[model samples]
Target: MDSVQVRPMQEDDLPSAERASAVTFFEAERSTRRVSDPEAEPRSAAASKQWIDRMRFYLSVDPAGCWIAVDEEAGANRAVGFAISQNRGRLWFLATYGVLPSHQGQGIGKRLLDAALAHADGRPGIFSSSVHPGATRRYRMADFSLHPQMRMVGTVDRSTLPVVDGLQEGQADDFAWMDQLDQDLRVAAHGPDHGYMLDILRLVVCRDGARPGYAYLDDRGRASLLAAAHPETAQKLLWEALASSQGPTLVNCITTPNEWAIDVGLAARLDIGQEGYIAVRGMPVPAPYLASGHFL
Candidate 1:
């Protein structure tokens, strides 16, 4: 551990940090699958330009909230762990945190987390976490209330899909209304993150009536982020997302307060499974919201 040091994450560290995260999460998922479905092959995390680009975006927005643990032993400055977070107004959201399996239990993760958390400056915080015991314990010690989260995954039963009304293709003009909805639901607007998401994902917006809502759908037509002023509006947006899917889809980050989402998924005949936890501090789990793993 003496050879390892946690320091602020730099643009140059993005590739190595992303690799560390990929390996860490891959092993974690493999371990979980060994218990839940012994025969299932867990998805592997491969390096991608998109991951580095996303981390670069986070660094551009909140460099102070990102840290990397590097081992300098044997003249190799290898990234063994990393934590990336961002501050959106008064809210701090952790984008990614991970320690390589070879480096686990060496206190590198704790040190990286502490450095990243220091950037929060006592503001409210939130992050979607895996069911790993050590990680959950650390989050609990940080005072975040862990809310069990569920995910719905399966090929949507198109026969059960309903006609969702008022949903239109969103444009840059909808950012103002979408940000307001974000503020109402999560205590702070997503701000610039929306722009990045819009560039890569499809934005479906329903600003037709008093109950406005918006959802960002990935290329596969899966909802990546969603929020609405009312449950009915949320359900409509979610229904549209599911109906638009080209193949198997997933709706994640379903907290207990968002039963409307569960109803929509169940109605679509998607299988429900325990995903992880949405750890939050200084706020309750937002209602009718599906948070982005990298931007919540």
Candidate 2:
């Protein structure tokens, strides 16, 4: 292959770039729901708008990331393939190497990747991303390890929950304790995000009469429960909010590869689909959890 060209994505290129991404992503076999579902990206106006809005987030947030590859022969160097990365001191991959159908397997995909990973400088953090089965083989060919982690969605209606006994949106004064601890925990787990560590404020003192605990929704519509003193408090808080939320209630939770999330889906009677997304962490994976929409 003649030497391929790589460059930074231009300001005007997102439209065509995203359209190409949608075509391939939505066309995938198991990507049926998240990629094609009304609630997923590549579907509806909100999804497209979100993708546009997040370009800046992808650039500033993903360290060691961002590159576009093109087929010089086709004069299609307008990011025929591109990468999205979050660079917060540590590297996290939002998505990398989105190629249009015409460019697949023509070495253009590998060229785009080689350009991106080349920036790793040998000892930098790993090249990370999540892929469904269709993209899995390609990722494997590039030497990225497949993680066992899965993204699961659970559902609950607004009737099965116990009465929300106490979900006071606590005063800032009361939050100092939780706030500091939260920040410390976040930085320890995922490094600094300036004030981002305290960004999610779903914690407030809740009481089922005498029992006091805290639970709050995180930024990504995901929920977090702080076991101030008891484990059940978190569960109760989440269950209460979930059962009371509008209709066809669903909550996305991130717990280590396990069940409360898995079983919740089973119990809520929601279909369990393994999102083609596989998180690629070299050795340590940063916590996108502290900030809910954390992709990279």
Local accuracy by lDDT, each model: 0.88, 0.49
lDDT of 2 by residue, 19-67 (tens): 6666666554234445445644345666666565555445555434666
TM-score for each of the candidates: 0.95, 0.63
Leading candidate by lDDT:
1
**Shift in Å, residue 46, candidate 1:** 7.4
Model 2's TM-score against the true structure = 0.63
- Name the best candidate (by TM-score): 1
Q: Write the per-residue lDDT of candidate 1 for residues 247-287, one digit (tens) a residue.
A: 87889999999999999999999998887899999988998
What CA RMSD would candidate 1 show? 1.9
